[model samples]
Target chain A: AQTVTQSQPEMSVQEAETVTLSCTYDTSESNYYLFWYKQPPSRQMILVIRQEAYKQQNATENRFSVNFQKAAKSFSLKISDSQLGDTAMYFCAFLTTSGTYKYIFGTGTRLKVLA
Target chain B: DVKVTQSSRYLVKRTGEKVFLECVQDMDHENMFWYRQDPGLGLRLIYFSYDVKMKEKGDIPEGYSVSREKKERFSLILESASTNQTSMYLCASSARTGNSNQPQHFGDGTRLSIL
Candidate 1:
């Protein structure tokens, strides 16, 4: 079984500033994928960024990036130049390359961007 | 753009009532997923379908059943709805290729209240 943990329950960031949401997972699988998803007030889940366990380099998508430390089993999301639209609930998810490809998600971190 | 559409944005039902949540995908994805989201808990997978007529139990399948008659539609059913089942239900779909590591496209979600 795999489990993802988001220690931070809630976070707040100043507008135009940067914020980092921490995430950790316990997985025995060597080949896996890590993802960060954002759910806005509209209740739509959107993919923020993704990182493959085999890829040592972190994944970056515009203002969203991930700090993936495979050895530490840590995958954190960083939002740079945060805006009001960035205020949402963020979740960290894991999926192994084998089996049914079901995703395991963390509890989530609610981020609020302050003006 | 890949779009996942859930049948209802909001629903209210009484206990012991049979509830059906419908999901449809426009991308012809090979995989479809149903998840429930609570206040603190992140998205928890209830069921998933890999192909037409092929369904699999996810992390939490208790009190939930699913049907996949077609490749583009997956339906989640609660045989007897309870107050505990009241939550935001999300539907997602993704392409299942060689590695099956593609990001999932999600619906806006259906907020169900079981009174």
Candidate 2:
């Protein structure tokens, strides 16, 4: 069984500033994937960024990036140059290559970008 | 662009009523997933189908059943809807052949309310 944990329930960031959302997971599998998903007010789930456990380098997508520490079992999401549109509920997810390919998600962190 | 369309954006049903949530994907994805999202709890997988007529139980499958008659459509069913089942239901699909690391495409989600 794998579990993802998002310790921060709520977070706020000023417009154009940067914000980091913390995430941690417990998994015995060595080959796995970590993902960050965003759910806006419209209730659409969007993929923000993803990082593979084997890849030591962090994943970066435009303003979104991930700080993946495999040894610590931590994968955090960083949103740079945050905008009002970035306000959403962010969730961290994990999926192992083997088995059922089911995703395990964290509780989520509600981010509010203030103008 | 991949499109995952859920049948309803919002639905209201009474207790003990049989509820069916439909999802269709434009892309011929090999995998489809059904998840439920609550206020504090993140997206929890209810069921998933790897191929046509092939179904698997996810993390939380109690009180839920699924059907995959075709490759592009996956249906989630609640035999007896209860108040506890009221939540936002999300549908997602992804290609799982050589690219199992691909991110999932999600639907807008169906807000189900069981009263």
Best by DockQ: 1
Mind sharing the TM-score for model 2? 0.97
lDDT by residue for model 1 over B20-100, one digit each (tens)? 999999988998999999888888889988889999898899999999999989999999999999999999999978867
Error of 1 at A28 (Å): 1.7
Q: Candidate 2 chain B, which ten residues in sequence have the lowest lDDT sum?
A: B94-103
- Candidate 2 C-alpha lDDT tens digits along A1-115: 8999999999999999999999999999998999999999977889999898999999999999999999999999999999999999999999898755688899999999999
In model 1, state the lDDT of residue A8: 99
lDDT of 2 by residue, B1-115 (tens): 8999999999999999999999999999999999998888888899999889999998899999999999999999999999999999999998886746467889999999999
CA deviation > 4 Å runs, candidate 1: none
- What is model 2's DockQ versus the real complex? 0.65
Q: Which tens-of-lDDT digit does each residue in A9-108 have in candidate 1?
A: 9999999999999999998889899999999987788988989899999999999989999989999998999999999999999999985568899999
User: What level of docking quality does candidate 2 show?
Assistant: medium
Fnat for candidate 1 (0 to 1) = 0.79
Give the C-alpha miss distance for residue B87 in model 2, angstroms: 0.8
